[model samples]
Target: MTRARTLPAASHLEARLGLEMGQYSCAGRKAINEDAIGIRAPDGPLLTTKGVAAVIADGVSSAEAGREASQSCVTGFLSDYFSTPETWTVRHSVQQILTALNRWLYRSGQGLPDARRGFITTMSALVLKSQQAHLFHIGDSRIYLLRDGRLEQLTRDHTVPVGDGHRYLARALGLDIHLEADYRNLALERGDLFLLTTDGVHDVLGAAQLAELLVNAGDDLAATCRTLCDTALRAGSDDNLSCQLLRVSSLPTPEIDDVVGRLTQLRFPPPLAAGNVLDGFRIERELHASPRSQVYLVRDVQSGERFCMKTPSDNFSDDPAYIERFVLESWIGSRINSPYVARVVDPGRPRTCLYYLSEYVDGMTLAQWMREHPRPAVEEALYLVCQIARGLRALHRRETLHQDLKPDNILIDASGQVKIIDFGSCSVASIAEIATPLVRDSALGTASYAAPEYTVGRKPDPRADLFSLAVITYELLTGTAPFEGKLERCRSQRDFLATRYTPSYRINPRVPHWMDGALRKALRFHPERRHGDVSEFAHELQHPNPAYLEYHQRPLMDRKPLLAWQLIAAALAVAELVTLALLVG
Candidate 1:
């Protein structure tokens, strides 16, 4: 019988994600079955978090351990998919598992007469997440989507055909050192049927037959899959046969979208004043206010502790996109925990308005701190940034990018502990996986601190945060922007690359030449040229990276053109003086 699974939603108004899965395998006329199939959908939140997964693998018959290859891959993928962090997108999670599986298979086959003889299999896997279906495949196993009674093949067979009716797989896991799985995703609709099949079953039964079986399958997907395999066997398939099927009975209504609908009911608190109480929090004073949002220091009436409360501006109270972004800020902040990050505190009380609270830090913003300490020593600046990097790592670990890393967004307490603040412009990868009708704001930050990738309309990664962090560190030590504060004026890639970097040593006498090299590399206009991540950038800040030191050791013109030109001009003046003296003699 087919197993139908439905994820239970916490909110009664939210639609659940549901799936019906079925699988069947048969050796048919073959002496050994080399095909493997699997379907997994955990109950509770996991059903919505990781979604339902199904994989089909057909081991290469020419391989000596074809059965082992097929079986290992099918089981390994199912187990590892759920093991990955919930913050990872389905594609990223599946890709990591596939890479690890491929590496293990390749290494285990070592010393054998032929590596492919020991491990080689064609595989196809599908994940139904949120309102979409993501596909990952290699070799000839096929995944087909039957929607509204029309059948369409979603994957291409990684094979090359020679003469006759024979096609050999050109791409399969364990066949090469590097594995490249083809990936794509599609919007899912209710009542959609997806089919997974190995060559044994698909070769004998064409798309027409598969569509016919699915149409008549009804709700008994198990019987439908078994019939598929049996029909293929009767059609004279001489190899092992396998078939797996999944029907999307329900697609998840994203929590954000559901909340957006509810947002219309919640009221934005009126402008707050000192001693005013709202939702158990007494306003102490307004910390900051802008056209979009306002920040206020509040006292928890029960706990009597102070916190920073952020409330959306009335200007955007009616804007769904703005409301969504505002909600995500609290969601992102509440999840990350680190000493270097401002901790979000749950009020433990029901709310009737739009706002969030974070622990209050008794200190000034890094921007103000920079103004007071003008031209901070390299050591002190690096120490502060290292702490800032720790907070960044916390967000990065959860697949979140703190797009805005300006000095104004960082705070240094009286105790000298640095805390990174602000998550308004962050980009969360896992959340990005969810389909939304509202447009998301670009992950652009303060132009001087934001990476050039955003200005060029390119996607950013952790390196974008590294770039912003580097800008903050550079200004702390040099008391000036690296590119003379021209990054904001750069509208395109060419403009950004053409801008020159002002050396930290030139702006501040305390900065050492080697330390300046680290800053310069981190401040590269191109994200790829910057450090790999926050940790690497933090490490290079304290330790000397010889590669960058040697890179800066090249001719003066390459490192600093202004200084190079000044020396050339001075040398020319001396030569002219010497010529005049000789002529007079």
Candidate 2:
């Protein structure tokens, strides 16, 4: 069998996202080699998204089906881990699989006629996702790391020390009805090496000896593995011998220039006229255009289906950041499957230029709708707010943030369904893990709707979206902003605190006082002061809370002393002006 394999670099941008692996197993003096190892290095999307996985298992020598148990655990974990949902985090997917595998092993052991002769094994697995390594371990098997010319054990040996330097296995698959596996995450650096070994190898070779052998072997991991096992056997290791080696050759950098260069290599499609056709799609009309991108209404020539096509703007042709964002927008839209969010369409045929298609929302933007209905009824405004909140919740659940949430980015279809659009400024948690140089200092959303925390250089959270929603809700109900657009001018926390909210009832008396309180809480300058979640904010809009009512009922003089004093000063000035005019006459 091939004992060594090396995964070449994935991409120029991710040169470090590759691994070299090797394994060697020997029975030594034992009758059979009850040890197994598996490695999976997939290509394309799986390689880019999930990276690589390696597993090593050592079966209990006392068990009758030890070899079968070890082989099954190793093979089962590698196959099942990749089959898990791509949306699941690495820890979640691996843990779920390990739990099921343990249950199966325990049940199989129970069916054995001899209680002591059951299927049992110790396993350790590693998953290299992005720039981090996730490790899962059980029983006495070990995983070690060699970095900066030093070797350190990464897994704890699950054994109880006894007299005369003897130890007993305390944890192993099928040893108990329940299993508790150890998990850890380590940041990966280029040229780092990792070693996985069963007790037969680790117990015989000390850390110094192992590190020396690995360093001497250099890039030949297969030779290193063979040498380690041979040394273990020479040191009187009489059990099944197994060892695996892995090296991180490269990792992906967070720079956007490479991604942008590849995406923009193709020229942007020329400005299309109503009768123009490109790539099987006929342009009906231009929908929108900005410095960042252009959107046009189009129809498939063959199927006659209407769609919206978006292409990067020539104005930003040299701006790598803008180009990267434009491409990511389409990528995000395609992955997210939500009715409340705009849908990205896959153009059946290949395209000659750089552009993407999306479902056409045959309705006006929320900004236009707000212009027509300056002061919508409370119920109508709440309905729209709830729909928008539901859309935001969908993005949040997928570990994505629609950072630029504003009236212009919201589309209200003809059927009155709200769909959030424009993912140019959106942030995806998974993508962020890939290491990028992009700075988060600039606020992604419009100043008027952006959360105060964003202006102060704080990371935007779910509450930030809630804050933007509240601004929209307040405007819908009162034809005016809660803070008279002061939030946009706030440069710091102090400026945000000094900005006072204008009462919704003062602008539109029809707006219930309790509803104003809900909006105020959601739009709080401090994220912590806002609603815990979007659902809570939506609930509060429809339900009247006694606390909000009491607060809203406070006398104007006490509630807003600055406004009260301004009114009093104005009245005195008017009286003085009248007296002076009368005396002069």
In terms of TM-score, which candidate is strongest?
A: 1
lDDT of 2 by residue, 352-455 (tens): 98899999999999999999988788888888889999989888866677888999999998888999998888877655555555443356678898888778
lDDT of each: 0.86, 0.83
Model 1 alpha-carbon drift over 4 Å, by segment: 3-21, 25-36, 40-51, 58-80, 101-122, 147-152, 156-180, 186-192, 211-219, 237-240, 248-259, 270-287, 296-307, 489-498, 551-574, 577-585
Score residue 519 of candidate 1 by CA lDDT: 82
lDDT of residue 508 for candidate 1: 88
Quote the lDDT for 57 in model 1.
Answer: 95
Over 1-585, each residue of candidate 1 has an lDDT whose tens digit, in order, gives 478877665221235777888888989998889999898877665665587899999989998777888899999999999988766789889999999998877777775888667788889999987788999999999999999999999999999998798888898877777998999998999889999999988889988988888888878888898899899988989989888889988777656657567556668889889999999999999999989899999998988999999999999877888887887788778878799989888889888898999999999999999999987777888889999999999989878899999989999999999999988988888777765656667745888788988889888999989988888888889888879899989998899989988888888878877878778888887778888898988888788788767866788898779999999999999999999999999
- Report how far off residue 519 is in candidate 1 (Å): 1.8
TM-score of candidate 2 on Cα atoms, chains taken together: 0.79
RMSD of each: 4.6, 6.5
**Global CA lDDT of candidate 1, please?**
0.86
Q: Model 2 — which ten-residue stretch has the worst lDDT?
A: 7-16
Point out where model 2 deviates above 4 Å: 1-13, 16-18, 25-36, 57-124, 129-140, 156-187, 218-220, 226-241, 250-261, 435-442, 502-518, 539-585
Reference-based TM-score, model 1: 0.81
